[model samples]
Target: MTVRPPQNLSSLSPNAAVDVLAAEIRMEKAISLERTGEAAAKAVAILNALPLDDPERPRLLAETAEAVWGYFIQRELMGQSSHGAVIRDLAIPREVLVRLGVRRMP
Candidate 1:
C-alpha cells in the first residue's frame, strides 16, 4: 500500500502536519530501500530535507537511527561486516540519541 501525506495539511496543527509528512517520507524511503537496497543515502537525504524548526524532526531522526542500527546488527549476526560503514556514515547525532533515551557507549 502506498502512503501519502494529508491533502489538507494546513488544516492541521504544525506539529501534526510535520508528523504526517515525516511518516510519509519515511514510508516512501523504506519502500525504496526494499526495492533498491539503497537506504542510507535516501534516508539521510530525507532527514536532512526536513526543516530544522519542525518539532517532529527529532522523533524522525531517532526512529531512523534505531532502524539503521537494527539493520546493522542483523547483518552482523549473519556474519556480514559487524562494523557497518553505512551506520558510521549515517552518524546519528548524540542529541537525537539522548532524546530517544539511548545511552552512548564510552
Candidate 2:
C-alpha cells in the first residue's frame, strides 16, 4: 500500500478535511484498481455504523492513531522513507479519517 497524507490535504482546515481525505482515498482505490460498486457499498455500510459524535470519541481516535502510527513505523523498519512510511501504514482512507474530524498532529 502506498502511503499518503489524507488525500489532497494541504492544511488542517477543518472544513476541507473531509474533501481532502475523500480525494486521497479515491486516488488510492484507483491506483490499486480496487474500484467496485460492491466495495463502495460495503464501505458505506461500515462507515454508517460508526458513531461520529460520541463524547468518548477519544477512544476511537487513540485506536486509529496507534494503528496509523504503527503502520508508519513498520514501513520505516522495512526501509521506506518517512514519506513512504506514512503512505504505506495509513489504514483508514484519508476521506473517512477526515470525516471523523481528526485534527492532524502538528
> Candidate 2 lDDT, tens digit per residue, 39-64?
43344444445687876555555545
Clashing pairs in 2: 2-87, 3-87, 3-88, 4-87, 7-24, 21-94, 21-95, 22-95
RMSD, one per candidate, in order: 15.8, 18.6
lDDT of 2: 0.48
Candidate 1 per-residue C-alpha lDDT over 1-106 given as tens digits, one digit per residue, 9 for 90 to 100: 9654467886788789889888987777566545333453455557767898999886677665655555555445445664446546656455443443353454
TM-score quality measure for candidate 2: 0.33
Best candidate according to TM-score: 1
Q: Residue 60 lDDT in model 1?
A: 71
C-alpha lDDT of all candidate models, in order: 0.59, 0.48
Looking at candidate 1, the ten consecutive residues that score lowest on lDDT are 95-104
TM-score of candidate 1 relative to the true fold: 0.42
Q: How many angstroms is residue 102 displaced in model 2 relative to the true structure, after the best TM-score fit? A: 13
